[model samples]
Target: MPLTILQKAKKLFDQKKYSQVISLLEPNILQYRESFQFYLYLGLSCLHTGDAGGASSYFQRARQIKMRDPDLLTAQAALFLRRGETDQAVEYYLDALEYDPDHALAKKALQFIRKKGDKETFLNMAETGKITAFYPKPRRTSLHPAAVAAPLAVFILCASIFGIKAVSLSVGQETRADLSSISLQAIDLKNSVEAGGSYRYILTEKQVVQAFENSQRYFQSYRDNQAQVEINRILNSNASIAVRTKARLLMEYLSEPGFDTLKDNFSYATVIQDAYLYQDCWIRWKGMAANVSAPDDRFGFNFLVGYDTRSALEGIVPVSFDKPVFLDPSRPFELLAKIRIENGSLSLLGGGIYQSVSP
Candidate 1:
């Protein structure tokens, strides 16, 4: 007898094997189309695997099957939050709260997004335990008697000779110089900040790079809010245009509905590796068309596409169009298509194809 879908999924989920869960459910989704549990499992699995669109679709299906399920509502809210849809997430979280007021995860997540105050709190939350844990505590050491006595004697001598106003002016000038030095240091450090009672530190370039890398990882892992914070850091920092452009593109991909999900300019490797995760996602790719086939009676036109003219027939993506179009195998072409994976190979399902303006 075949193992029940939920039972098998629960076992995989317990093992933290989310991809296996997705593989198990996807092929059987049509068979258990009406099962709320099936959709819920599939949605959670997709969310874990960083397939936000897939998770959203499955969650919506589950919600349609059973709207009042608090878990489903919370999961949907999380998906919305990960996609940077804060208002939608807030509404869904509120709906979930209405169903289950004491939902701890929803309450915590809501508080996390809503609370706004203090650089320390923001940094602490953004870096989690990493920053605070690495920060050394102030050492409890006593000042020497000679050090105290020397300062006290100097203060008395200066007060007797210069009077109060002269001493005050001298101290003020020194204080101004100290402040100026700090201001200069802040600028020189690029990404340094004063935190907690005169303590100052600069984040090294490596740290900044690591932070951005973490943000990308979080985004791919369906941790959108965390990813957004890091992306915003890159956007607001003195980072190079290349880094900022990548962050902006990622933000647009997550936040803009008009943007196509399949076509990511930053990470082509990710798209290739996780093609199945983005099945049905639309992309606009510019390449050279080759091996063009005549329009079939039923299926339409087909061709193989390569990234450039030199490799026009090598490592090509199989593409299909609904109608016959003019093709120039030598010149570059552009395609706007929905992606599909068939029998472990990538293909374009259907969309427009045209000649490219650039070579």
Candidate 2:
């Protein structure tokens, strides 16, 4: 059944349709969230498509589901290798070998590391996302493919050959069924945070408690953007590690709101009054673009908030967009952005943008 859930993604992966595999699998994540194969392939697709952040996130999610997976270790090693981190790649490959001593890919990768000197050999392996890239693939017998085409046919053949109980036992052993429940368990941080390390108490105990309570309250009301405001405060504050630790965990459950869903949003005018209270909150505001610059993939500009009226420029805040947006220096624009507290002032990371006619 687990294999059945990931069969479509596997087919797409085998066909080397990496981007299409991502498109097909990402949307239906809820259906197969428990399947290790699903996230591994999704992460690989992201890796191949040059989305390192997405790939890293998916791979971490996969690790939470199954820690001792050899293919996942190999893929992570490939990711590190692609980034030219041979030492990290070696560590991951070694970890894979510890799990599967005779694992072909890990063994072969180690051998290449011993005898070979060229970084390109490892780089190519990373580029192809395979330790076996330098080697030729084995040919399978043509007629052997027809023994089982459908899932039912495969199941029947296996059942007839090894009895129904044997089939179940094989599946159970292959997937480490005993550890499946423990796989997704959260990391116990009680001891780590209780010590509180070397942090100074920036906010008073009462203030810290207030922030936490407010965050929890907003979380219950499904106002995630508002909830994050408090979380950011805790993170940026001199709160003890234990309280900040809980704040970080609570943060994991907060989801970003969309345009229609974001409500009761405070504007830049309101945010400037108490920026600390609105840390990491989203705001919708419009202004003129001044001194636009495109360095690398991001667009940066000084946003003239509320300057569309031309009567008064409420404030000038720096903003950058990760997504491609139309940028004209002489234009007024509406920016729906997440506010970041930078250098005791506000900046924005663009979530969405709307362009108006150039003035």
Candidate 3:
């Protein structure tokens, strides 16, 4: 019997005949439309032939068919790294780890790159020197007199200030009491702001300004959860509209991809807390579709989402899709979406929803 197209492709692929694999697979892709393995093999074949675009399309189709496939994620990450897209490569690698933390290849690749540092550093080292058994001696340099004196001056200044402040505080009971009162007041003000209190009524202008400054410091340090809490407090407090708007914008900026180091996959609560921050950023969220709306004239759809099927629809989030989405209320779904916050309401703008496989 003559070998089938898929069998021939597989045989050629295993024999390292990548071009032959492509020739066999390309024309027969439609015939194997439901075969993820076919697309995956074709993608790998294209990758070996240096046809990155073709490989990417094939890989993407495979991903759409099975989004959580760790092998596919790792393959895509490798492709991204080859293309010099380090950030995207890292993202995909991290995502693969999310699915399978023990994935040895992804783990090893991430470790190697992280230790090697950036590509430029690696290239520079490679171009500047050749490997040899014998190596040249290093040049030595002496520290400048100014560099030595600078640290001495700073040390003396800091010591003097510390001594003066310590003496002033030790001088009187009244001064100690006053300082304690002030410290307590400052703590109270901070707690009030973090708890979503109206700082205008309880704190002076200087205290309010200090609280805002402290919150900004938290934001800069990647403490986004704390920053969002403070921002929420400011929004609900009796702050000026200008201050509130600035707070909203700051919250939105902090929710961007590179801002938070701790979270790769943001929760729905995270999105709801600062929807504006996640705007234009991709998110992976899971929820059950409660009420799926018909597609509008623009082919957009809206749906109310519950965290799970058994949950009540009230207080549920409204998710808008710029394109129609096929939803089944019985099955829980996950979506990789771009967030949109309009008129203080959060919605998903446009992205495909992935239905969970039936158990």
Q: Would you list the rank order by lDDT, best first?
A: 2, 3, 1
How would you encode candidate 2's per-residue C-alpha lDDT over 1-359 as one tens digit per residue? 45653677777777778898899898887777666677778888877777866776677567656666667787777666665666666666655655555457766765566566257766676566564352211112111111112234333432343233321323212111121221111232222233334443356666777777787777666677777877877787777667777777786655555454576688777889878767778888878888888786667889899997787889999998863454456766677788887888789887666553324
lDDT-best of 2 and 3: 2
* Model 3 per-residue lDDT tens digits across residues 1-359: 99988778877877879899998889886688766677777887876776766766677667666665556777777565654455666656655555555556656666655665376643443344321101111112211111212233333333343231312322211011111212224443444333344443444445555556655765555555556556655554555555555566665445333211334455666667656545544566556665566544222334444455546542355566543344456677765566666787876664556664342
Encode model 1's per-residue lDDT on 231-280: one tens digit a residue: 65655555544555666666543431112223243223445765644454
Candidate 3 CA-lDDT value: 0.54
Q: For candidate 3, which ten residues in a row score worst on lDDT?
A: 130-139
Q: State the lDDT at 279 in candidate 3.
A: 52
Which stretches of model 1 miss by more than 4 angstroms?
A: 116-359
Worst 10 residues of 1 by lDDT: 172-181
Q: What residue pairs are clashing in model 2?
A: none
Quick one: best lDDT, which candidate? Answer: 2
Instruction: Candidate 2: list runs displaced more than 4 Å.
Output: 1-207, 236-238, 356-359
- If candidate 1 were superposed on the true structure by all CA atoms, what would the RMSD be? 23.7
